[model samples]
Target: MKNLKIALSLLILISVTSCDDFLSEKPDNRTEIDTPAKISELLVQAYPQMSYFDIAETMSDNVFDSGMPETLRKNEQSYNWDIQTETTDIDTQAYYWDACYTAIAHANKALEAIEDLGSPASLNPQKGEALIARAYSHFMLVSLWSKRYNPATAASDLGIPYVTKPETELVTKYKRNTVKEVFDFIEKDIEDGLKIVTNDYKQPKFHFNVSASKAFASRFYLIKGDWDRVLELTSDLGSKPVGKLRDFASYDLLSAVDQRLAYASSDAETNLLIVSANSIVSRSYYSNRFYLSGARYPDIFGTATSLFNKPWLYNFYSSNSSITVFLPKFYEYFKYSNVTAGIGDPYVAEVLLSNDEFFLNRIEAHVMKGNIATANDELEYFLSTRTVGYVPTDKLTEAKVVAKYPVIADEYTPFYTMTPVQTSYVKAIAETRRRDFIHEGMRWFDVKRFNIVVNHETTNKPVNTLVKDDNRRAIQIPLHASNTGVELNPR
Candidate 1:
């Protein structure tokens, strides 16, 4: 009993130890972290310390000028593809470079502390989480500052520094690795973590419980083009009588605002993990709902001469749903928060992983492997939740989904200047992701992985446009870390 009490007390201290503090200096050697229980406290924070989506969100096609105020200047510049927008000085949004490494540092410390504990079976769970946490952090870091992992060019492309040791002095100086090396390290960590991780966690949703860790692994394999591994991981989920998709119809959709909040609720069955990021209150685009047509904002449904002219292009929220006309559609602002989000969002970002993502991941894998029948079944299972009155029993087809959820419609278009979109199963997946994971910045990862060129425009007489790619795709390393030899990505 006394030992449990001591471990809990150490954990509280660990939780309060901000990532910044850990990065700024080394831990005192005298502090006792040698025991498994004490080491578990450090592993409690295996998740990324910050929100992972903002800058990438601005760089994607999901957002538009929408006439809403940009809470921060960086958001506007980012959306415009201004080369100098995300300087180290602007700390408004979560900085991927620092946040990711900080997470790695925590994981490394946990592993190092438990090294001499002999990694007995009793200590496997802690060791598993630490290893997985380390891999997840590096995966996020390389995903952003470095280019997407492409085998052909990865051998030559520069990757983010992959930190392994918990020692601060070692982390203080580092060099970039090839993209392939970062991916190899991530894979190795997952293997090591999976071997030790237990399927059961006391707080399953808060940590990477058995199912959640599998889900994370499935995500990684999908990106690596390993369809068989994805299928193997999801084999159990495939035959379950009730797939893990959230039954949106079961929610009170009669009230759109209430429903949006309900979908993102803490206890919502859709969530596998729950984490909240601070809402950047200053950025208008971050919380905007305005979409203009001509000099005046247009109504969702046209009346009289032009009847029933509704815009279509797979946006999360429609004009009618967002009560605050200028607020971003699809988000439910039940309350306000004061925390800053260079890490993640306060309430909305908390619903990071869910059954919805798993279903989509399986569907994509099935499609890639040419199992169209299986893929269709999974897709139908998913649409039942998102589309009102959708019947999953009927055999659904790719054509049906594309028709019902077309990105472009006859009468109205979104406020952005768009290039032609291809109609394929992949596009279908991207559109579904944009809707299912809106506002949370989940769509940006797909944008980078596929190198989807998104163009943004200013509503001026001449109409300025920025075609985003190249240097804009990668983030610049923060100046704080620059003195220590971490090379900044070309911006």
Candidate 2:
């Protein structure tokens, strides 16, 4: 207990002192004399910090893809399963947790400083942007530290502490809030944010634009099952004057495949916010040099082998003796640049948040409400645009596919029956999303969200189950948070 207390004291002291470098810098008249711009710069710092929460490094590669060796094509696991910890490496979790809190603390500092500056109206858009950034930081922290958003269970589940002010004193203890409270707070922040940050601005390549803020809100709405709001916000996304996906044939597959992908690449017209390559490269460097290299089990494919070695497999490989196995999607996405590239454009491909996803979300709601026909039509519409050569009216029936290509899944299951249209929709969404997003960090979330049973297609058998409440679902809360008396999610 004494040692723990001492450690906590040190942690708080470190947190407070870490920002001294920035704080110590000579303040220009703008920062010292003016209030709003200083707050805006603080908010800007908060935005780039989110790129530190890389889904690939922390969640996808560490958790969802960890099991791919046995389930996917050609890989081997030399270490016993016991060697695998929950969600991510202990060190990795610590790093992410620290990064998140650091961001939160920075935002908190801005908010704290702004409070003394004057009334909220005095700061205008800057105050709103600061709040938005703080809320986003908290949202990311809780999403990683807590379980999936289950409106039913969230009221009871533990969430990260909602710290609103910078802690200057040493050894401040905190406790968890319920997930419901966390999300409620996040929603309130977004509402507040929406009111202030109305104009678009072009600044550093790494900062969040106004459209990106809306995109984040759109994502939040989608996750919360607010279909109307999602549709309303995403409706104007792909229209003229915004952005669109590049034509499939026009994609420079070779060059684009291995490069570190930002939110928007050069070809993208509507990507709202993309993490810069510097952030990616820095994180990737840490992951490759430390975490991946130190992993106990050999990759299934072979260490040091690229995931694109066979794009069809979509799994890791082992080199004969190397410690690293290339993620094909990661490789493909960042193929154009080397490790040291600076931040790229935020728009890569206008991530069409499409009416399709909205349609599917509505179908899901309808299925939950037992409206079968409406669900089926909506499902069909979503599938039609997804499958390239097919017309929008092409039926997605099992019989049609079985008749056309003898090699598809066995018996045709109707959209109703024991194989619920909901199930079909989930599968369709998963498969289509997997193909479309590739390395964009959406696949693993699909696996977790739907509790999908991943199977080894080569072996024609169920491989493993990834669901909430499973060990696979719980990432270790950063040691710093845990040490500070913050309650972590149960495994």
Candidate 3:
């Protein structure tokens, strides 16, 4: 591992790397990352520590003016579809941008260390994890900071810098890659990682385990309109997805706090990958000026909104003033720096990938592939667990799903074409996803992919509508990154 030592020596010579301090002066200076064990330890930081829930959720159609007096700059900016100015806050868009790159820096460092260790077969797991981690961070970055992937114009759309190599210089100038280039880079990393990725981590749920990696692949292909690949990636989850899906029914048996704690627990088979993120999103659920309001709560989770006409198993809670409403999904844990002073950070255990979401992705793939009956059957079984008082004898047919989600012309106009029936099924799946991941920020991806319109209203202000193909759909690149020569999105 002489090469590794030399690399470490060079790292020591450098100060903080990147304009945003994405890399430290010496990441592993305390101990050499010469061994596979050390590389694995380093991989723990490969996932973004900051949560994008607040930024994304506020921008989606799921929220409205709660009439709450509390306000966070990030929340207000996101709700109004404006560029965020809160660059240093834990839950702001800029913080998440830097956090994603920071995660990528760690992955690149581990990959470099692994290469220096001779790229032995013994370190395949670490190599696989590092590659997938790098891909995931870049994928998130491009998905947020760039326009939605449109094959016809991806070559021209500005993407976030896809950093793959460890930084050795104090300050590295980076240029934004094209959307097509970023997607190409991400796809290459994912395919390579999948070949050798394993589920052998001490805590598989915290790392890019086999299932989580496959879930990510399915998500990527689904967005790219590669229906066949999406199905191939999620095939193992089965058509029924009986035990692999979330047990929402059982969550009702637990206390509210317990449900929040168990939502991201490794014990839950549905949770494929979870990470502790520096976030105040849980607190924001009930405190933000704009959030899921009591008036709009029924529009999403009410019994009439369900296909089976049953109440959702999701538990809802109200703020002290009953203005804001939220699901018991996020659990915040305080990490005390000084126990006596009660000063520290708020962390939320976030489920980045899950069997439930993967299963929905598979169903969408089926719908896109013209397997209407199969998609209907799978969607039926998948929703059963989440629907209260679900009757086993009741069958969900394609006709019924289509009838429920009628094709409103131009409601969803993605790059790929969809038949009327396919459009209905896709709409059904998107709605399910919207309900399933209410406060998790997953809806924002669907909003972009489907070109869904979001009408956000505030007290005494005219309705702010994010219409289809709006330029604001793509969040602007962080001002600091733009100042450093990275391209900002067109307003």
Best by lDDT: 3
- TM-score of decoy 1: 0.77
What global local distance difference test value does model 2 have? 0.46
Off by over 4 Å in 2: 1-34, 48-91, 120-122, 238-243, 246-248, 253-267, 277-419, 453-468
Q: Report the Cα lDDT for candidate 1.
A: 0.58
Local error of candidate 1 at 292, Å? 11
Candidates sorted on TM-score, descending = 3, 1, 2
Two-way TM-score contest, 1 vs 2, winner:
1
Write the candidate numbers in order of decreasing lDDT.
3, 1, 2
lDDT of 3 by residue, 260-302 (tens): 8788889999999998888777787556888888777888888
Writing each residue's lDDT as its tens digit, candidate 2 over 1-491 gives: 00000010000111111232443343331133235656665665564332332343334433223322322110111011111222233223454455566666667667777778875675656666666677777776676566667777879877778877766455578888887898898898887877776454554223444555666676676567665665565555332221243233233243323222432453344344434222232223123322233243233222222111222222333332334333322221222223355322221112323323333444454544455565556555444433334454455553432232242242222212324344444454444454445434455455444443332211233444333355445455655567678765565
Error of 2 at 71 (Å): 17
Index of the highest-TM-score prediction:
3
Q: Give TM-scores for every candidate, taking all chains together and pairing residue i with residue i.
A: 0.77, 0.63, 0.94
